[model samples]
Every structure is written in C-alpha cells, then in structure tokens.
Target: MDITQDQTLDITSFFCPMTFVHTRLALDRMTSGEKLVLILNDGDARRNVAASAQALGHVIEADESLPGNRARLVIRK
Candidate 1:
C-alpha cells in the first residue's frame, strides 16, 4: 500500500498505556484515511501501541525497526 503519513508522533520516552494513549490522541485529531508516522521505543511500547491502534480499527501500514532499539509504526486513522 502507498502510505502517505500526515503527522508524526514520537513516543519513545513513554511506555505501555501512555504509548497507546499518545498514539490514540494523535489519531483522534486526524481524519479518516490520514496517516501517522509513530516513532516508538522497542519492547512493550512498540508491541502494545500497534496492537491497540489496530484494535481501535486503525490500519498499520508499516512497522520498521530503527537503530538503537527503536521502531517506526505507520498508522492510518
């Protein structure tokens, strides 16, 4: 899919619920079909944030691992 992200959210400093919370807030502010480039830390935050966004009916366009235990999650809201 061609993912054109409209916004970016960096939640690398957060964990768990906060990670998803920030992502959700970013999504909530966007229109349908718009995309977000979410930069998150590895481990729990990356996993849970993607799952939670998907559970809320958003689309996970891409999930790429960056250097230093980080990840970039592209979400369509």
Candidate 2:
C-alpha cells in the first residue's frame, strides 16, 4: 500500500534515546496507519531509531540515506 505521510519530524539534532524518544512520541500522537517521515543523522541516531521503532512494532516503510550522513526514515503507525 502507498501510504502518504501525515507528518514529518526532524530528530537530527537529537541524540540516542531522545532521537527515538521524539520519534516515538510523534508516532504516538498520530493515528493508526498514518505515515511519519523522520529526518535523522547517521551513527547512533540512525541505528537506534530504526531499532527502537521496530521494537515497538511500527512498520518501517523506507530508510534512505541522504547526503551529509543523514537519512530519511518513513514509519507507519
């Protein structure tokens, strides 16, 4: 299914737990099946965020790395 994102969040400046914390909060604020696009920096933010989201059973639609060691992550809540 093609899911259109209902919101976008930038957790690039956030670190570790806060990265996934903010992302999780955003997803919680959204309704079911709604898509959320997140902007996250590479390294721990990237690895932890994906792991955190997946652990919560949120469906990951896309995880594409961009320039400047950043990535665009799409999650379905």
Candidate 3:
C-alpha cells in the first residue's frame, strides 16, 4: 500500500548516481522530523536507494511495494 498525504519526490526515471544524488539533495532541504516520500520506479534505485539514505544519517522508516515495480519509501531526518 502507498502512503499518501506526505511530501513526495518522484525520481522514477532517474538513474544511479543521479537517483542517489537527487534523493540526498532533496532530503537535505527537509526539516528534521519531517517525512519525505519517495517514489522510485527504476530497478537500480530499489536496490540501493535506502542505503544511500541511511548513510546520510537519515532513516528509511518504511518501504511498501507500489504498482508496476515502483516502490514507496518514507525517510525521516
């Protein structure tokens, strides 16, 4: 199930370095305790996006499968 009603950042078609890079930049702009909802449609992003977020001192609190191989992730700073 998808989590709606949060700020969403869609990086579906973005590739590797860009995927992680954009996620980081977006997260950086968010305030502490605020949530960031990411919709990643690429396969490579599903493989490593969470790690990138964790490495940046952020916590990927939840991940739920969305339709069409897309994943919905929530991160808290």
Q: Pick the candidate with the highest lDDT.
A: 1
Q: Rate the local accuracy (lDDT) of all candidates.
A: 0.89, 0.88, 0.81
What is the Cα root-mean-square deviation between model 1 and the actual structure? 1.6
TM-score of each: 0.93, 0.92, 0.84
- Model 3, 1-77: lDDT tens per residue? 44432478899988888888888888788888878888897467866898888877888888878988899888887
lDDT of candidate 2 at residue 74, scale 0 to 100: 94
Clashes found in each candidate (C-alpha, N, C closer than 3 A): 0, 0, 0
**For every candidate structure, what is the RMSD over all alpha carbons to the true structure, in angstroms?**
1.6, 1.9, 2.0
Tens-digit lDDT string for candidate 1 (1-77): 46677998888888888898888888999999999998899888988988888999998989999999999999988
Query: Lowest summed-lDDT stretch of 10 residues in model 2?
Result: 1-10
Give the Cα-based TM-score of candidate 2 against the true structure: 0.92
Regarding lDDT, does 1 or 3 come out ahead? 1
How does residue 26 of candidate 2 score in lDDT? Answer: 91
lDDT string, candidate 2, 44-71, tens digits: 8988888888899998899889899999
- Which candidate would rank higher by lDDT, 1 or 2? 1
